[model samples]
Target: MQCMLRKQAQLWEGAVLTTVGASKLPKRPKVLVWIPEIGDEAIVRIRIRKQNPDLATGDWLLLSRKTDEMRQTLALSTDKKSLRFLE
Candidate 1:
C-alpha cells in the first residue's frame, strides 16, 4: 500500500505533484505531495490554512515548509490541532 503519515513540518522543504482533499477539519484539508527525501519520494501531508478555492483530487500545489505561513498560502499549518492526514 502507499504510504500515509502525519508529522510536524520542517524547513527548506516543499511538495509538488499534489492532490488536496477533505481532512479531519472541514477547513484545512490534507494534501498529498511527492517529496524527495532520503533518496526517495516520501508522500507527506502538511496541513495549511483554508484556501479560497479548496483543492481537489489531481489538483496541483507547490507548497513550502520554509515559507512564511501568512505570506505563502501553501505554507504548512503549524497549529498542532489542525495537523493530520485524512480522506
Candidate 2:
C-alpha cells in the first residue's frame, strides 16, 4: 500500500474592493478580494463615479489590500458576487 500526504494552501488578504459590474443595485456588490490577479474574476463593492461602464468578460483591473500598499492586477467580473479560489 502507498500513502500520500496533502499540502496546505496559502491564504491571501481580503479587501473591500470597489468597482462596477452588471447588477440591478445602484451601488456595486460588496465583495471580498482574497487573491485578485490578472485574468481573475471579481465583484464590485462601491460605485465607480468616474470609471468607465464599458467592461467586457475578459477585462482586467488593479486591486489592493487594506494592509498592504501593493496592488494586484485582477480580472473583472460581470457577475455580482464575492470572489473565491478553488483548490
Candidate 3:
C-alpha cells in the first residue's frame, strides 16, 4: 500500500494527531499504522517509514492521496500484497 506523511487537526492546541497513539504529553512521539485497518483500540505491529518521526509502533494516522484534504482518524491493516509502504 501507499503511505503519505500528512498532518491532522487535533482538539488540543499545539498537539497534532500525528498517529493513532499521540498523547498530549510531548515526551511521546507520534506513531504510524502498520495494518490498513484498526479493529480495536489496541496497538498492532506495523512497518512504518523511517523518515516519519510522528509514526511509531502505536500512533494514529490518516492515509490517502494528497489531493483529498479529508482526514479520517482510524487504524490500518496490510493489504494482500506483501508490499507495505506509503508515499
Candidate 4:
C-alpha cells in the first residue's frame, strides 16, 4: 500500500475590516479590508474551516490571493481557513 499526503497551499498576509454573512448565502461569510498595497478597500469572501473566536473587525489576517481561471477574483485558501487574528 502506498501512502500519500497533500500539502497545504501558502496564503498571503492581509487584514479584514468586518465579517458579514452573505445575503445570497447565509452560510458564507464575507469580509471588507483596505489593501493600500493593492488599492483601496477590497471585499474578500471567506470560508471558515477552524473557527477562531478571536477573529473580528480591524484584525490582521493571513489570506490566499489565488484567483480563478479567469484571474478576476481572489479567493481564500481551500485546504483550511488561513485567517489568523492579530490583535
> Relative to the true structure, how large is the alpha-carbon lDDT of every model?
0.32, 0.34, 0.35, 0.33
lDDT per residue as tens, model 1, 58-86: 23333454323222223332222333222
Ranking by TM-score: 2, 3, 4, 1
Q: Which ten residues in a row are the worst by lDDT in model 2? A: 1-10
Off by over 4 Å in 2: 1-25, 36-64, 67-87
User: Candidates 1 and 4: which is better by TM-score?
Assistant: 4
Angstrom error at residue 30, model 2: 1.6
Tell me the spans in candidate 1 whose CA falls farther than 4 Å from its real position. 1-42, 45-57, 67-87
User: Which should have the higher lDDT, number 2 or number 4?
Assistant: 2
Candidate 4 residues lying further than 4 Å off, grouped into runs, are 1-41, 45-55, 70-87
Pairs of residues at least 3 apart in sequence or in different chains that clash in candidate 4: none
By lDDT, the better pick of 3 and 4 is 3
Worst 10 residues of 3 by lDDT: 1-10
Error of 4 at 74 (Å): 6.7
Ranking by lDDT: 3, 2, 4, 1
For every model shown, the clashing-pair count is: 0, 2, 23, 0
Decide which is better by lDDT, 2 or 3: 3
TM-score of each: 0.16, 0.19, 0.19, 0.18
Best by lDDT: 3
Show where candidate 3 strays beyond 4 Å.
1-26, 43-87
RMSD of each: 17.4, 17.3, 16.4, 15.5
